[model samples]
Target: MTRDATSFDALYKAEPDPWNYETSAYEAEKYRRCLALLPRCRYPRGLEIGCSIGVMSAEIAQRCDSLLALDFAQTAVARARARGIPNARFEVATIPAEWPAGRWDLIVLSEVLYYLGPAELDRTVTLVAKSLAAGGCCLVAGYTGPTETTLSALDVQDRLLHGLAEAHPRHAIYKDRDASWIAAIFECRTCPAGG
Candidate 1:
């Protein structure tokens, strides 16, 4: 099953920096690699799923004309908003159900997909394929370490890549895997109409 908002909210309430996003060297390096993997230096529009407390959102905002960052937990969203990223807007939203309308030039799914159930993951993959603009890119990154969720990090990336292949050609600009994490950047060379 997908991890519920209540559980995430409780986690944030218990610890403002549950994952130490702001202070962890591991996260800092991960974010660095993620930012470096982007094919372009700037994007007109961007979306970041599960932005947590906006540590990465602040960095992404520097490269985007406008960015929309989402987290289901109200507490997490509130914390992200408090960062006051000028070009980024933080909102409370759950994926595959509350996906924002319109195409995105860049969409990032960092350390979030494994929390989803199979069906939710499938739906999310479809949503991503349909919502990406032509020449747009989607970045998927996650911890390869053991997880309590139904899908492993690699499983989530593989399923998303498989589903996207059906909708559009996969042009992987970057892909990397280490003992701790795996990340890939898939570009949509040509999107179907209305995407």
Candidate 2:
């Protein structure tokens, strides 16, 4: 079973910025590079899951016309909202459950997918295909490792993601340094909505 929203709540109850993405230089640099890869920086609509505190969402807001940033924890969502991303909407939502309506020009699963189980991952890939705008890109980035914690893990997300790539198409991947991290970009095939 994937760790449910309640577990994430417990995490936020412990620390508001658990990973320290806002203050950590390493995380800030990573976000900088993540934003740098946008083939079309001016995307019409962008969606990101696990948008802790919205630092990256703020960065993405600069590149896209509108963005929907989500996290399972209310505190995280609230903090992200306070960041004041006028063009971005912050919601407390869990993936593949509250998958947003309307096609997305860019979908990001930054540092979050690993928490989901295989079943959730499979469902999420399908949701990504359905939600993608024609020629839209999906970026999945997370900590790749054998850590004791769940969800923060990354490695095999690439396999699950790639196995579905043939059906989705426009697939491309880029990994950060091998030190327990990886990031990739994928584009879904032309769906009816996108077409």
- Candidate 1 lDDT for residue 7: 92
Deviation from native of the Cα of residue 194 in model 1, angstroms: 14
Best by lDDT: 1
TM-scores vs. true structure, each candidate: 0.95, 0.87
The alpha-carbon RMSD values of the candidates against the true structure, listed in the order shown, are 2.1, 2.7
Per-residue CA lDDT of model 2 for 1-195, tens digit only, reads: 456777778887799888887899888888877766666658899999889788889988888899999988888888899988789999988887888899888888887877777777778877877777777777777776665544454544665476547566655555444466677777554554535
The whole-model C-alpha lDDT of candidate 1 against the native structure comes to: 0.90
Residue 176 of model 2 has an lDDT of 49
**What pairs collide in candidate 2?**
114-151, 115-151
Give the residue spans of candidate 1 off by over 4 A: 191-195
Candidate 2 local lDDT, residue 84: 84
Candidate with maximal TM-score: 1
Question: For residue 178, what is the lDDT in candidate 1?
Answer: 65
Model 1: worst 10 consecutive residues (lDDT sum) = 169-178
